[model samples]
Target: MDIVFTVLILLLAVSVSGIAIRLLPFSLPLPLVQIAIGAFLAWPALGLHVTFDPDIFMMLFIPPLLFADGWRIPKREFYMARRSILMLALGLVFMTVLAVGYFVHALVPAISLPVAFALAAVLSPTDAVALSGIVGKGKIPGRLMHILEGEALMNDASGLVALKFAIAAAMTGVFSLRDASISFVIIALGGLLVGAAVSWLFSFASTHLLNLNEEGDPAPGVVMTLLIPFAAYLIAERFELSGILAAVAAGMMMNYTSVANAGPASTRIRAGTTWSMIEFVFNGMVFILLGLQFPHILGRALLDAHETSDVQVGLLIGYIAAVAVALYAMRFVWVWLLRWFASRGATKHGVANAVPGLRTATVTTVAGVRGAVTLAGVLSLPEVLKNGAPLPGRDLAIFIASGVILVSLLVAVVTLPFLLHGWRKHKDPHAAEETLARTMAAQAAIRAIDDVHETESADLDESAAAYAADVTARVMDLYRRRLASLDDEQESRDLARRAESLEFTMKLAAMRAERKTLLALRNSRTINDETLNKLMREVDLSETALTARRK
Candidate 1:
């Protein structure tokens, strides 16, 4: 217990310092730095000892992080970029598994193809948390970032699904193609349905129960919001379904169902706070875990390397490298193909009707960096086979995955900045707007000035009201005329964007007003805190859902 406490304190300090370092102008990957810190601790001189449970890694880190990413992913952008997301999520993962697995088996004739495929599946998708951290740092356009986000968010499930199948085949010593296909379908569909249902139910419950005014009333609702992702995941997993898909579906349902029904102002405030907390805790845990595990995994790999031949080591390295490369190459090719098809249709409709240039596609490919989950899966690979037999090439497999992760992160963090800058210089106006839209936006300075003064009460205080009226009149007249003067499409879009922002702000204000009234009644001892909290949560969920869509 003392050791755990000390380790946690040191880990937290390292994470905090890493964050501070990242905010600096110098180009450094925070995760890489954290990993370096871990290695320093593990050095013989420092002699730090720490251990993390494999089950804890899966349960604690994976679900919430994945769920949070899924929850925040805007539905509108996802739909617009569906073709690319699907190709990357499903097609790329499947292809990488096959390509990586085949190459590994060919290079090292000792291990069975199924086990090799298991390793391949583990290496399939780039880490969303890692990608988000690195790409979020770069000045990439909004649309391409979302497309990359969607791919990373969705592919976690697909990669995991493929891995489960591979593991089953390896463990059972047999696999049926038809059965695997059927199971995959079932898992994916089941997770989706369960997630959607759970999220909807929670959203429904929250909306009716929230009473905004009662003291301490919002706490229960916050707890409920936190639980939804885990509940959705666990329920699906219990039925042998895809927990990842369930969490994703739940997130989507929360976005669409809750947001559509939420109060604009209070909901956004609450959801934003909740999401911010979720992001902080989950991200902190993930990166820290990544760092902490480095020495352990490296030690295992070194131990494995001792018994393995140099040829075998080279083969394993080449195989995982190939897997990472294959995933990137597929992204580029798929994006090019999709854009070509979109362009063909655009020729009839006009080239302007097509999707953005191949540059965005290239940027997406460069953003693929593997992180914690890939490492966890590789490390979780058992050291011993069935019947007390030694598992051939376990260490080599871990070493390869580690190399893939390191290389991918280095490439993404270093090169993404240049790629994004180039894309920014060659910006497409429409694509840029679509990409950079704020998820939880405030109203424009002018529109906000208009709305606040418009609502001032003339009856309550005449002098105050008169002053507000005068100010509002001048502001509106000046802005309305100034905005009316612009004729260009870009100018129109800028105004339209402002108007949209004002609309959501107004909606949020209205919802909060209603919530205030409901809470006043509750404060009169008419309603329980639990009921009030539930409703508040629903309202918050709704607001979050709506805000995410705009972004």
Candidate 2:
């Protein structure tokens, strides 16, 4: 299919998956369902063949995903879970590659050790986007969620880097541990430096533009925010560094620099809506695309039957199974040990809350699913070696990788709900933790509102200042009332929630009225298109806030 038609198909798939997410029973994950749809669509009988080109995949897919992940990671929570994240992302990744690599080589004698390592590396990193479905709907612990997110964010770089070196060794017939280790550090650190620098440059430009357009359009800053990851990735890749790391670093830098935060409320809200759309399309499509590759892998493996040895063909299934089993087995052992050590000197509740027990460790192990990265890595395998012969076992590697990915995703889909279901059965369904979080957020909001008087806006005009102060006072009063009534009384809490919702409805009416006025003025030619768009977006921002509450 042509590129445009391919994109349309993916977008359609994403839209269908989104609708299915709301419609389907809670037990089914949208990714798995969407992938199944794609598999049927891409079957040989259907003739909808979409080629998997690695460079295009890298350029179009990876950067924004990594950047979005880095941007969305809660900074405070990431820091709190940093230790566990590092152990999983770096230590567990290395162990899985070694252990799985050796086991796969042992199982399939035709697969070289380096090629086996490449397959292992390809399958190492978990897809954060795939697992997000489980964490979003399920009541997983907060620390566990953060570590899972944090590990996914970083482990992609580690796994890809390992894959690259292993591929090089496979092609060149030479391998050096010390040189590979040193080069890995260089690539990682260099990517970080480049990413941070590019992010800063973009932030500086965005901030200046926002300042210039304080009372005007914010399109400049919005455009720049969208470009930061692309620029960072391209620049890093040009310098032979890790583009994934570069994109991730740039995202975190944008968060730290407050580039997005510095924009006007309307701009920030609009940008968020745009990002949500991008993430939905990209995330939903990746899994489907991964599934689309299955037919090709199976086809190629069948085609290789006559060329490769009987042993190679015979061992493919066993190798795939061995690799998939080894991944979880190693992960379970590593996490269980780590959890036990971390639980020491900590309370039973606290430790379990953070790391949980053997059951949860098993759940977490299953959830480390391989998806797009694994497919992309194996698909990028060289077609021919330096000696001009076809790369041995390329089809086998792709087949093995696809099988492992599918198995891992299947395991996660089958196991997560049952595991988390049992875990939640023992806990209070009406969680107190959520209420505590709400109260703390409201307290912080009130504190910020209290400081508004010191701003320049408070000194501009008496009426406006008084209006602001009055609004803040009323909001603070609602929060105080809500706080005082948190006595495990469901009726009182529900009443407060309804009151808040009513307030939002009333505010939404004002925003709609403002929007109508702007439209009227624009129709009369009293305001130009630029001013109209700006004012309309501001109204839309307020409307967005209120609409969220109404929902």
Clashes of each: 10, 0
Q: Which residue pairs come into collision in candidate 2? A: none
Model 1 per-residue lDDT tens digits across residues 1-551: 78787557665756675576758777565566666665666666755656656556776667777777777787888898898788878888888788878877776666678777877888777776677667564366677677778877777778888877877777668778899888888889999999999988876676766642333445566677778888988899899998878887887777676543454455456666887876765665566666666666655555575568777555555665675676577667766777777688878875565765766667767777787778777777776767677677776677667777777888887887777764545445565454333211222556677667766653548888877788788766644544443324687758766776787798788778868966986899788888888888787777766577556
TM-score for each candidate, following the candidate numbering = 0.74, 0.82
For candidate 2, the per-residue lDDT at 171 reads 93
Off by over 4 Å in 1: 3-7, 22-25, 44-47, 210-216, 258-267, 303-361, 383-386, 424-551
Model 2 stretches with alpha carbons more than 4 Å out:
23-27, 209-213, 299-315, 344-356, 425-540, 547-551
Best by lDDT: 2
RMSD of 1: 8.9
The pairs that clash in candidate 1 are 142-435, 143-435, 209-535, 210-535, 210-536, 211-532, 258-542, 259-542, 264-508, 265-508
Per-residue accuracy of model 2 over 61-122 as CA lDDT, tens digit each: 88998898898888888887889998998899888889988988888777888888998898
lDDT of each: 0.71, 0.81
